[model samples]
Target: MSLVVTPLELPERWDEPGPRGDAFRAFHAHAERSNAMRFGPDVVARSPEERLASLQPSLAEACRAFVAHRDGQLVGALKVYTPLLESTDVAEIVISAEPDLPDAEVLDLVEELTTHGEQVAAGLGRGDFRGGSLAAASGAVTAATGFGGVDPDHPEVAPLVARGYVLEQVYRISMVDLAALPDLDERLAAARAGAPGYDVVAWAGETPAPHRAGMCRLKEQMAADAPGGGVLFEPEVWDDARLADFEASAASGGRTIRTVAAVEGATGELVGFTSAFVGTSTVVNQQDTVVAGAHRGHGLGALMKLANLAELREHHPNHTRVVTWNAEENRPMLAVNEATGFVTVVHDGVWKRRSVS
Candidate 1:
């Protein structure tokens, strides 16, 4: 199979009022439709008007869009960032061909893009170009691209592994569902029967002023417990402004954040907490759920999860299904998810690469 790859200037291809601009939008729509499991329906549901409004600013700044054509037909496309402030050089490549595309043709397309990426990085005085979600079928492309492995859990890791990339870091993705969640009242009653002194309240995002200090401490403790966790981030990490940004982002995407906390009646210390985000797609992305070490074995985790699901159902009545991802090794958190009615629908591994030369 023969293919032609071309570099597209963002302004020329994606700017307002251009033929190439329309093509770019159509390309993304096709990609999202073909890869629904990866990109999700929210992206597929984006109208052309919405796409233009949402992507115009980013295109003006760091967009590098490319398209692959075979015999005058568009076959594949990629989008890469051009060294922004928050990112050195992050890139994502999407292929629209049928899954049956030959390995050789795919590798050829990857090599073409990698060559362009190297040129772009060098011109910007950067040493590496990072790509995410390389997929299991793109092993040859990863090897040909010369990107070293950074993390195995990243979506791109499996392909990198097939090409000899080493693991750098591993992070866990945890999740829960709302539809099958246990009855919160039943769990609360059971907890009350066992430990009548503790007060369990659903966090309505209106965390009480008195419990703020305890919540801060719990946040710090959870961060500290992160496996291979790095230097402690400042309080600003969980400050009101940052939390508000999170809330706003979720709201914009038609998702709701629910948290439930268990507090000690005597000292008002926060002992356990669980948080869930209900997305427009009905997938409940479990953000963080933890019980402080001092409060383990009290069934507080289940109580919080149950409460969050109940509140989510109240707010978002249209949601029918939810999904979450967790590391295969998180026994405690996995136990809570299992008890609360979340089952694994898909298992994905993440991969990363750094300092590709």
Candidate 2:
């Protein structure tokens, strides 16, 4: 059967009630289970509404989704999003085929969706694409050499690799139990003592003006500072307006972000910081954590993380656990997380495609 792909009518069908809505929900559910089959049970597919929430346009990116059907039955999907924070010539794309689709057909669907994603990005005046990706959890390839040979068994992996994409990083999803934490006070005390001449402070909802400037500085440095795993993150262009938009959009999505920042007592400049955000949902996401280059090696990373966790314990008391993802090669940051009782729970692949012209 020949498959047809077109822009999905999200605004109309998203909140629509009835059989059509049921079909819409069923379409995504099938795609999710299908993708999970490739990765494993750890995929933990997000609910349709949660996926919609992720698609909400941000200050730096715009999103679009498409449905692929053959004879009117959903067969696959394409998600295209471009990031202004990254280079103007780059976009992120994800394509999925129904789990039951034959391997050969999966390749065709991926190629078609990729071409569609490229067209979408080109329409935005962008070219190259840098998409975060996933693959089967084992030894299909090594990190430094890009994607190696593909097992004919896993044809779904070929499209991106065949399109000039490379595996830049491996991120492992990790979680820590708040209820079984080793000891809050002892760790917090040690963190404070380890980093002298700095004070740790916490915030919720919005960043206050005094700390806003410093916090923005650390945030702006985020992409460049972290280990890129051979991929350029393309430093985000940050400003007061951009930060405001981020906080507002997040709150509108039912998320509440809590942050803990370490301030230099003498200069009052933010030296390091960590943030955790939770929605009406149970899981609390441990967000960006960074220490100014000048402030590293003082155990501040641990300090801010512990301080933030302590704050969450008080505020989001009912939250069961905290989750985060870190590059597999980032030993320092990963060390801090593990020291705080975080353990690797899942693995993911990060891939990117460069422009030919």
Backbone clashes in model 2: 0
User: Tens digit of lDDT per residue, candidate 1, span 1-357?
Assistant: 567666643333334667667676656665556456454554224444433333433311355556677787666666655534334543333334424456566565555555555565566655433443433312333322232213334423434455543332222333444445446567656656676557777755545677666676676666556332111122222455444444454444234567778888797788877666554455555666678898877777766766666666777666544555544445677787788777544333333344456
Whole-model lDDT for model 2 versus the true structure? 0.74
Whole-model Cα lDDT of every candidate shown, in order: 0.53, 0.74
lDDT of 2 at 112: 78
lDDT by residue (179-292, candidate 2, tens digit) is 877588898998898878999888898999998788778888876788776666677767888889878776654578898888989998988888787764456778788999
**Location of the lowest summed lDDT over 10 successive residues in candidate 1:** 228-237
Residue 119 lDDT in candidate 1:
65
User: Which candidate has the top score in lDDT?
Assistant: 2
Model 2 worst lDDT run, 10 consecutive residues: 144-153
Off by over 4 Å in 1: 1-31, 38-159, 167-188, 191-197, 203-220, 228-237
